[model samples]
Target: MPFLISPVLTPGALARTPQPTLPTGDGLLLRPWRAEDAPAVHAAFQDRLIHQWHVRSCDSVEEAAGWIAQWQQAWKDESQVQWAVVDEETDELLGRVALRQILLGDGVAEVAYWTVARSRGRGVAFRATTTLTHWAFEEIGFHRLELFHATANEASCRVAAKAGFTLEGTKRSALLHPDGWHDMHFHARVHGD
Candidate 1:
């Protein structure tokens, strides 16, 4: 069966090309995850905040490697894409930014990110997310992008706003964290916005 309206973006759009490395003005580069990143990823998971917000931890380097493998596969599947945000000069992992829950037909995805403890308060997440947002809208032709964060996460709320996402509304108990369900603040940016 076919619908009257055509798909917003054709399938295989992402799978057709390799993910590109994006650079930010703040001396950061968002690149594909590498095998060597497993140790950094595992170490990052040990951060209490990361573990609490993401609701998962890499117990060992092997498990972190598996996570990286899954992220790589997601790009080929056209279901999601993730980038390891690293220092431009040193190539040290600073954070991560991703567009997950991608819907090709709808031309939409959810933005997610996290920063290492040292990278916090330095605008790493904001810069990386802004770069990814531009790529998603201009390069890939996404119609809209959505971002959600636990309402209690004031820092994340700031990042969303800094990245040009408008606060839309709140979803009650939309996400489950280690402590309990969290009310999520919904933010979005459309093609023109």
Candidate 2:
């Protein structure tokens, strides 16, 4: 049985290639996660906002290492791809950006990211997200990318707008946070946009 349309991106398209490191032109690079970066990951999670938005925290370096391992496996499985945003010069961890919930046949995925406490307010998230969005559309052939965040997350709204994702709408109590269900703002960008 043949389908009317082929997958926009083949299964091996990502797994066959080593994930490339992307430079943000603002002193940061998005690279693959490394075991040695576990400590930094653990530290970043300790920030209340990061933990609250992400809904999980690394209790120790070991747990962070486990997360790194999962990220690697996700790449191999072609289910998701993540990058550690780091300083270009010192190679210090600054944040993270990822394309998650990918649907290859549909040519879509969700964008997610967070900046470390010190990296906040400096446009790190916007730059990293824009870089990943470009790679997703130009390099991987994805047609649509979606970004959703709590309506209360003003910072994320700014980043989404800065990265050129158009506001779609808001979902009523779409996601559950530690405190309770929160309305979510839906934003998206397509291949041309």
Candidate 3:
């Protein structure tokens, strides 16, 4: 079964639901996305590598702001969970990890992420994914989390492995990349191991 984000949950409902803050080893923290984060989010997505891996290409700052607004409302609706990976000391944005395509009934959500090029290979994605998974299971009560990495992206595959997600298989011609239709590796983490 596929899980869709429950769009009907109200702010009060979300407020009553406990959300846990996750701390990363290198002075990074994962928490809910804020409207004020629009600027940083916009800057992070400008990288070509980020676009290739995450399938995000924003045309302008306004576009990023618009997306952030939607994410803010998503937090209120208790549907999709979006988090900003921030430096604990300076509170500077480092990247983002989000659980989208969420289906509450099926107990599943899709995890996607991007780390700024400068921050890549620093275990940022690994730590963030692990922390987010723990929060999703503990706070959101999801039974499964799914991650899809482009077959061409070895770094992402490594990140998934480090985060302890099982490589389930591949979806052939799953995504249309700039180069061509590409294979996608599916990884998953289920509740309670």
Candidate 4:
């Protein structure tokens, strides 16, 4: 029995999946990231807060372009899904939201988001998160979606609550920040929740 083994990845294991355009609310939409959006993404990540929490910083346009490319490859790898939150009227970038760490076999995902500096306090993150939450639960058929944030990130915590993601608990020193490790608060929305 100890000698017997099974394959973890079989033939046709990973497939390229279609990306979707989702409408959050009030003329806001979540669309697939485009190469053209790299400039805006670069500008948005310039904020200190974004770097404080998001670790990965798109310091330049080239890095931003690479970021988008990596996300595209992630989609093909069936590992993550991402979107650029935009204003439907002006087509201006508001923020970015993503369901990463996707475990398809277990039907689990982690939602994360950030607003452009100019879009902060406008509920851009909240609306996008709320809309994405529903989509992940119903349309995408995921059993559970979770959102985790540093305990010090009050804004993100508020957004998660407003999006109907219940706070599960805190993981002590689970995230390593630039300054030090952080205790991350966990929030989740399960199917039928």
Candidate 5:
């Protein structure tokens, strides 16, 4: 597995990011969550747009902090890795993208992501997903990267397609939403050209 270390954590915080060794892209960096980042992460997840599609509601900042702490521990355990995406030029937390569901026996993994509402139209998710997927394939040597999204999430579908994942098909009645069980699109990108 590859790791991410942000040059943003350095003194001055204004320089080219040293390549993450993992293929997390050139213009953006994905690094581990910090305790100081809790407030912003909480605020970003609070966007109704994000919660409706990505996760259940997290009602308060305290709840968000708890989630972040858990995420940190997960990374330490090598069970899952969630990244906080930040712009290299400005060091602002643009969003988050993660790779989970590590199936070591199958040599496969699943990718998930979200971009801050204010940053939606700017290709943040696409870049983050691309970077993460490239790292997963090249460094982790995973054979398949899977993605799932609610059928109503057209934006997510578009991002996955743009990242070169093929939509395998939909799984009927696969996910339980607030309304009811709903179909989900299954997409994947395999290693190699």
Candidate 6:
């Protein structure tokens, strides 16, 4: 059965990442999402900034539950890793961070995230993102991790920079936004970076 190409080229060939609480100093912890988090997640997505970039929404708690369910399945499929960014002291859900579009074969993946309005202006996204990048490159065996955001998303650009991602360039109309198709900037971090 070992005939064709290098085993490393096939994505997700390594064992799935075990769910663990990834901690960042100052009481932040990134852990797997829980069923009880549906309401909070729903509320977070209600922010215009979130739906504007994510191109997805949840109208009801039921739908939010489904969203959580879908991410859970993505993990089982080894196609994604999602975590709820929480404040360990108060146990409040601050945001979410995930590595999606995972190509284990190519040793690469894409990072995505959204934070609640309350979490905005904080370093939540940057810290959580940096933590995830390290895990992807060191633990998940990915050589590169890329982050794409709408050209108009200045906050994300800053986060990418602060997280050690260098701007690679723009992808013309690479993603569709609510107003119409929009250009995207691709920021990346290699293994040694």
Please, what is the TM-score per model? 0.98, 0.97, 0.87, 0.90, 0.83, 0.92
**lDDT, candidate 3, residue 7?**
39
RMSD of each: 0.8, 0.9, 4.2, 3.6, 8.4, 2.1
- Per-candidate clashes come to 0, 0, 4, 0, 0, 4
Q: Tell me the tens digit of each residue's lDDT in model 5 across 55-128.
A: 47777778878888988776655556788898776768888888788655456778999888888898888988
The candidate scoring highest on lDDT is 1
Worst 10 residues of 5 by lDDT: 6-15
lDDT tens digits, residue span 11-129, model 3: 44344654446787668998777677777878888888977766658877788889988877776566777888888888888888888887766778899888887788778888899
lDDT of each: 0.94, 0.93, 0.80, 0.86, 0.77, 0.86
Q: What TM-score would you give candidate 3 relative to the actual structure?
A: 0.87
Model 3 residue runs over 4 Å out of place are 1-15, 18-20
Query: Mind sharing the TM-score for model 1?
Result: 0.98
lDDT of 6 by residue, 1-193 (tens): 5758664545445334456678886678999888999999989989998988878877999998988898878777878879999998987999999988888777888999889999899899998998888777776678888899998999999999999999999999998877899899999999997
Candidate 2 lDDT, 12-84, residue by residue in tens: 8789988889998889999999999999999999999986787676799999999999998999998999999
Name the 10 consecutive residues with the lowest summed lDDT in model 3. Answer: 6-15
In candidate 6 the C-alpha lDDT for residue 37 amounts to: 95
lDDT of 4: 0.86
Q: Which stretches of candidate 2 lie over 4 Å from their true place?
A: none
User: Candidate 1, after superposition: displacement of residue 59 in Å?
Assistant: 0.8
lDDT of 6 at 72: 77
The lDDT of model 6 is 0.86
lDDT of 4 by residue, 139-182 (tens): 76778899999999999999999988999999999988888999
Instruction: Rank the candidate models, highest TM-score first.
Output: 1, 2, 6, 4, 3, 5
As a whole number from 0 to 100, the lDDT of residue 142 in candidate 5 is: 69
